[model samples]
Each structure stands twice: as C-alpha cells, then as structure tokens.
Target chain A: MKISKEEVEHIAKLARLEIDEKEKERFAHQLSDVLNHMEKLDQLDTEYVEPTSHILPIHNVFKGDEIKEVFPMADPLSNAPQKDHGHYRVPKIVE
Target chain B: MDYEAIIGLEVHTQLLTKSKIFCSCSTQFGAKPNQHTCPICLGMPGVLPVLNRDVVEFTIRTALATNCRIAPSNRFARKNYFYPDLPKGYQISQYELPLAMDGYIEIGSNETKKRIGITRIHMEEDAGKLIHGENLGHPDSSYVDFNRTGVPLMEIVSEPDIRAPEEAREYLLKLKAILEYIEVCDCNMEEGNLRCDANISVRPEGRREFGVKAELKNMNSFKNVQRALEYEIKRQVQTLEKGEEIVQETRLWDVNSERTISMRSKEEAHDYRYFPEPDLVPTVISEDWIEDVRSKLPELPDAKKERFVREYGIPEYDAGVLTSSRSLADYYEACVRLFPNPKIISNWVMGDILRELKDDERGISECPITPGHLTGMLRMIEDGRISGKIAKIVFEEMYRSGKMPDEVVKEKGLVQISDEGELLIFVDRVIEENPDMVEAYQKGKTKLFGYFIGEVMKASKGKANPALVNKFLKDRLDCNV
Candidate 1:
C-alpha cells in the first residue's frame, strides 16, 4: 500500500518531528517499500499454516511472588542531563 | 435500532525474565530513569541483537497455558517506527511468524461458561516510558525513561468474541489468573507490568458485517478497560443511529472525563514497515525441546479447579475462587493435607481467612497464618475445644500477631465451655429468669428454645460449646418449664 505525501506529512506532525518537504517525500517512498515487502506474505498459501505467537512450549513462568528490593534511584538519575540531589532536574515543569 | 457491541483485547505483558529480550540489561521496573539499559537497548551503533532464550520459554509456557499450538519455526521482524521512547527507532516483534496461535479460554460462572477465542500471542520488546509534565502555558516536552525499553513482552491478542462489559472484565481477569498461575508474568497492573488495549465495534443485531472500530488506549486498570469499552460502544451506537460515519482511529481514554478522545487517525499495519530481522536467525524449536518444556508445565488453573471439585467435593464456584491463583490454591491444598476436610477448609479459606486477608490488604502469599495454623484452628473447632465464634476471634489474633492458632486460643483462654454440668447450671438460670419464653417454649413455640441457648452462651462468656448448650437448654426447658 502506498502512503500519500499528505499522509506522510500528517504522520510526521503526529510524531512531533520537524521534517522538510523533501524528507517527507523520501520517507513516503521508503515506508511504502517496506510495506510492499510485508504484503508479499499475503500471496503465500497460509490457509493451512498456523500463525505462531510464541516459540516455546512452556507455560506458567513466575517468580516466588515475594516483594523484592525496590530500584535504587541513584543508578537511574546518574544518566540524566541534570540532577538536584537524587531527583532528575528537568526544565521548569510549571509556569 | 437494536445493536450489540463486539469487543476484543490486545494485552501486552512484560515477561518476568531477568534480562531484556535481546540484551543483558536487567528487566527491572522503576529503575532510575534508565539505569537498567545497555547499548543494545539504547540502540547504540555497532550493536547486535541476541534473542533471550528465557523469553522464548516464557512465551511458550503462556502458549501452552492458553492451549495454543506452538509453531515449530518462528522468527522476529523489525517493526520500523520513529518514537522518542523507542530508542531503536524500530521494535523487534513477531509479525509474519509468531510463537503460538488459536487458543481459547473459558470465562464466566460455571452455569454460564463462555469461551473467548485467543487469536495469537506474539513476543516483542517494550518501549520506554514517557513522562509528560506542564510548563509555560503549554504541556512540556516529554521525559523518556528507558528503564522499560527492550524488556521482553508478550502481546496476547484475542478475537472479537466478547459481547458485554462484564464479560470483557471476566476475560481479562481469567487471562490474568492463567498468566499468574503459570508464572509467565506478574500481571500487576499497578506497576505497569501488564497493560491492555481494547478494540471495539458495534453492529446491528444479526448483521454479519461489523461497523468501524475504535482502538482505545491509556486504560490503566481492568475497570477502565470495561468502562472505556462501554462508553465507546454507546458513542458508536449513537453515531450510527444519527446516520453518521464512525471514524476508525486511535483514541485515548480520558479517564477523568470518562470518555474517549481521538488521539490520531488509526495507522494501518503497513505503517510499521515491518521486515525480517537480519541480525538474528529464525528460531527452530525441536520436538524434543517442546516435549521438555511441556513436561515442566504445572497443573494450570483449569485443571486444578477441576481437581478441587472432584477431590474435595466443593462447589465449582468455590473451587474456581480457591484455584484462581497458584499460591492460594497451594495454600488451600496444604490446609486440606493437614486437616483432610475439604468442606471445612473451603469454608475457612473462602470465608474467614479470605475476609481477614482482604481487610489487611494482603494476598495469600503474604498471609501470616500458615496452613498449619488454619488446620489447627479447624481441628479445635471440630474437637469441640472452641466455639466457631471464638475460633474466628482466635484467627484474627493469629493473623495480627503471627501467632499459631493453638497459641492464640491458649493465650486468650478461648477454650469452649463444653462441660455438660457447667452448661446445665447456666441453663437453669435462663429457664428461671425467662419464664415467659419458657412458657412459650412449653406451649409449642419450640423455635424460641434458642433464647435459652443464647442466654447460656452469654453466661459462659461466649465460650460454651453451642451444640452442648443447645442440648442442655432443650432438656432443661422441656422438663422444668
């Protein structure tokens, strides 16, 4: 299925990307190429082929249902661009 | 203009594996914004994806639990997209070939069992979480937390077979129960471990063709799932009645407004640009491998429910409730193994024990009173050492103080006053004071005989064995009054 230029522009807006008109046209073509490949599966004889959802035959995998240790905040906050004490410091959250 | 709503659910559950689906990054929730991530999950350049073996096993286990046929050869595809939280730009998911398919789960009470069809269960990696905030008169830009990115997820999609809101809730609950029973997923909605998106459409009665369906997202709980579906159904039915077209789109459930709002026009499957992944090879599951996994499968909820009914002589409803969780069922069976009275254990677990645990915000796994203690309490009641009411009081103490049932009974001096001679003395006093009730009892108002038993129990400080009190009160009242 071919995605129109206008649809590509609309999708780019929804995704919050600042794209030029040329890039939009390029993406439209690239996306259609990918979808065309996926569409090839439709031509295969799948009437007798079962769609697989999982690969293994196992079931009922669980932990011991015990509440374990909470995640340490220091580890995650260290990667943030800015931090105040242990909390992540972002741009002013409120006006 | 009679109409009916047909609903289906697509549930995405992160498997409880130690690592990510294709990397060694720990699959831990709530890590500092991105502490659990590595290069593979971060989508850094020069990285290759390695499929997690445990993920395949967990997915297979879920398939077996749902009675799905596992495909012998399955592979992953890259679902190409460009979202901020998706660091890789494209998510590796099963598209052309999934792991399992065509399973069904039965829901509703035994008298009205409805089979809900499961379409497929596919494995994928989770995207990161986006935290939205307020800033400068407009919604602030989002903060991406990669802690959840690349976590192994199983997306179980169901056929559009549900008809009502209650049935939808039941289907989710039963599916969650089965997942929990098999230990595939924690199924915790509060922690965002398991989430569901709903697809709903309405049709005129007896119509073979379906109306335009809306996909609802951002429902945080099962109640929200049902309510959102109900609201959408009403909205769609009203739109059709007005002779208007229902747009097929992705909608967000504004939980506060209790309505659905269009997030965006629905994207077709082609939008994903899915292709077979080149870095990984197709998984070939051998017959012996399938057999090995199958042999390790535990007795699932349905089988255990049936066993509880047949072996313990309990009602199907009670069996279902007790066997809803593996831990609860194990707890119940352990109590029976200690006491060997199915009816009595069922009553205790379903009635007093469950009530106490719920009041304390505890599950069976967190319950302080072990099966041994419960069985001991039941034994005391059966041996006439404590009245049923006193047993309840001791149970509360046992749960609160982590004391054994026998210890609590002894510490509280809650032994039953079963001495016939002692009960006779109390019965004499009741017969004298309530001469009117005695007269009424002698004059064939025999049901009023319970008044004497009540008085005797009160006189004995609620410790008098009820059966003994009843016998003494009846004999004394019959002869003297």
Candidate 2:
C-alpha cells in the first residue's frame, strides 16, 4: 500500500499539478497512509459478502414520456467570467 | 485475423429527482453556475449529509426494471478523489453493498435476442462541469462550474458480454428505453442527462483470460460510444499484434478525430480509498416499501410489446417500435381504441405522423393532430366516405389547421364519389375514348386496367370511390365493349 516517490510523481503529473519537491514527498506519505487504511477491508472475511453497487432495490423509475419544456439556455452563461449576448464569451484570436 | 470484439458499457444516469442526493438543492439542469450548490454539496465545515429518500427509491426502481436482485441492506461509502468539480474531495457513493445487482437486458431483434448482463446499479453524485477558458494567455487554467455538483446519479455497469459495435449501441438504446419507460432519468444525451463511459479490451481468439483494458471517456452520444469502441479495439489489437503491450490506461475519446488518446493509467478500485461515510447511516430498506413501489410500477416495454402483438394483432416489429416509448405506445393504443384497427393505427403512427414529427423535431405530444382526429380520419376511410389518397389531404389540413378530420374533409369538399349511376357515365366515356386500352385489358394486360381506372378517378376530380370505379370500369369495358 505504500506509494513510492516515482508513483507519487506520476499521479501528480496525471492530475496536472505543478508541485514542489517537498510537497511530493509529503503527498507520498499521506497517500500511503490513506491506501494503508483502505487495505483493512482485505483482512475481513468477504468470501461470502457480495460487493454492493447500489443501495436501493427499486427498478423502472421513469416519468411520463413527454418533452416538458424546451432546452433552457438563459441562465447557464449568466455568471460567466465573460459573455457575448447569450453565450459564454472567450477572447478573440485575431489581432 | 480471426477475433471478435467484446465490449460493455458503464452508464451514469442523473435521476430526475427534485433535489440532490444528500441535500435539498433543486436537481434542475441549466442554472446559473454554482447557484444550486450549498454547504452540504460544497463540503463546507460542520455540514452533515442526509440521504435523499427519493434517490434510494429511484435506484430500486431501476434495479427491478433491469431484473436485478435487490440487496436487503446497503450503505454509502466515500470515494476519495481530488477534483474541483467535486466540492467534497471524497464523493459519497455506493461501494460494499449496492441497491441492486445481477440484472440483464434483452437486446437485438426478437428472433436474435441477445441478453446483456448488468453487473450492478449504484447511486452517486454528479461532479461539476469544467469550463476551459480562464487564464486565456496561459492556456492551462480552466474555470469550473459547480452547478452540477452533488446531483444524484445512478451508475449502471454491464458485464462484458457485447461482441460488436452495433450490440453496444443496441444495449444503450434498450437501456435508455427502459429508463424512459420507468421514468427515472430523462435519457437525454444532448443535455448530458444520460452519459456513458465504455470499458473495452480485445483478446486472442478463444482466449479465457481478459487482456489489458482501457477506459474510454467523453463519449457524449451512443453512436460516438460505438465508434470510439471500434477504433479503440482496432488500435489495441494492432498494438498487441506488433508485440507491444496494451497498457491499462484511461483514454479520452477525441470525437472529432474519431480516435482514443491515452490520458493516464487506469486506477484500481482500491486506489480511491473507499470507506463507509460517517455522516450517513446504513439504510435498511423494508420489504413493504419495495412491494409498494412494485405495485405502483407501470407496465414495462417488453410486456407491453408482447400484449400489443397478441391483443392488438400487430406484427412483432411494429409492436416493438410502437412500445419503444411509453408515450408513443399510449398514443397508438388510444388511436386503436377509437378506430379498432391495429394495422391502420400502426401505419399512421409509424409512417406520416412519425415522419412529420421527426422532421419538425417535435414529439407526439407536440403534434397538432390528436388521437381522436386520427381515429376519425381512419373511420372516414373505413366507412368509404373518403378515399385513402384524399385522407392524406385531410391529414395535412388537419395538421395545418388543427381541425378534426371530418371538419377538414367537409371544408375541403373531399367526400368520396360513390354514386354508381354518376360514375357509370364517366366510365363509359373513358372506355369509349380509350378503346385500345380496353382491348388491351381484355387481352390479358390486367396492369393497364389500373391506368383506365386512374383516368376515370382523375376525370371525376379524385372524388370517385375507387372500388365503385373499378367495378364500373370492369363491367363497362368487359361486357359492354
């Protein structure tokens, strides 16, 4: 369950982080601690215990097959950092 | 060169509940960024989570629809991850005991029923969407919209039983139909209602153990899911043939390029650091509650399809298509009850009505013609009040004016000309004018008889009853001529 230095560096890169050297060493220890704790499940007698995926037993939950309303586009771009009328605005490329 | 592609899908559907899984925020889509979020979803300090009862009920409904075995007791687990979209660093999801497991959905045509095994259906919260444009100069940083954070989502995983791209698409379509019938999720891919992430791998012919699998992401549509899987299967098989190992990685589906690019190594289930959520207790759902939900369950698609075939006497294919959506089946049955002809009702719903609705991007509810109007039109044809060709005109007028079929036919003066005496004069004139056509008809050229009949009907301004015209034309041409 221990995370090696190389593994921590790889995970950091995958997560797109610009971490310092000291932070990498620290995260290695923290991640290893978390994984070690999770590994405790392996010690339990789960031979007969089935892995659970959902919590309810109900099925066929549906609504009336009707298109209630048109696609709402009014508010998605209201709080955008930039906006051009109704769409989310971004910077132009042409000089 | 002798191998098959075995593919299976893991679909995550956001249930259309009125609130989040653990909070009271509205589960509505397309709101202002972060407007639906609160302390519980934001994972603020001292904010405890409570399970939404509706979400659990919805999960059970989906399990029963897919013929899954419901668990007597299940609990929530914290799937630990660090992402901006997920306000809680650890997402509350099902892990050790899910609500349902070991269900199967029948796909493909009736003659070739392929049973796709559903491994599990679990509940989780949706993460926020990433709006990638902040820090425009740097081209690295992206803004995150937390509006979708903590929305209730059910992740249904299927066993790797699919062997082709078409079967993969069929599985998704059938599952979406079931979801739509059961009224759990909207199943709208365009609005991000029903989304799929496919796990695919290729193996040597007749090999027992599975090969290194790659998880494909960002497939927005069912077609894209199928195409991306096909492309990945080819790429993986080629890499393995070149003696290169097919690494277990997470790949992004570049929809524009129609190829998969490796993103990172696939994480194992244990890597998520899953543990029981301390905020919520293990839910012990009662059998009485399950039975109550079951009693309220509507007739599912398969049973309805069978009934439509047996009771209505429609073909299996027509019944299948009609029962694809509950609304469509209801509309068809309503028309049938009024008209009492399954074949005619099927034709209208599957033909002009569906074509018109699809072309205009509308649904059955949006159609101008009501089921009553459609039945009235069929009745006109049945009673020989109007010809089938004229019924088409009446239908168009009905759609345009929102008028009843009888009113449209009356206003347009579209009544059939069934007057045998009046039609005999027109038939005599046609037979006298086209003597050669009559002679040709008598000489075993039966096909040309339709031409003469057409002339008679056209001469009568399309109001001539087709059956009477045929009888008059045959009598005048054969005996009198």
User: Against the true structure, whose TM-score is highest?
Assistant: 1
Q: What are the per-residue Cα lDDT tens digits for candidate 1 across B60-86?
A: 888888889899878889888666678
lDDT of 2 by residue, B1-481 (tens): 6556777789999998887877777777777666666667767778877777788888889898999988887777989776656667788899978888999999876889989999999998888776555343324445566667878899999999998888999899899989998899989886799999888889889988888888888899888988998899889889988989988888888978888988653454236768877667667767897888888789999899999999989999999889988889999988988888899889999999999899998878898999999999998998999999999999889988899988888888999989888888888888889878778888888899889989988888888999999887777767854
* lDDT of model 2 at position B406: 81
Q: Candidate 2: global Cα-lDDT?
A: 0.82
Docking class for model 1 is incorrect
Compute the lDDT of residue A56 as modeled in candidate 2.
Answer: 52
Q: Highest lDDT, which number? A: 1
TM-score to native of every candidate shown: 0.85, 0.84
Supply candidate 1's per-residue lDDT for B338.
94
Candidate 2 TM-score for chain A: 0.68
User: In candidate 1, how many Å is residue B413 off?
Assistant: 2.1
Error of 2 at B479 (Å): 3.1
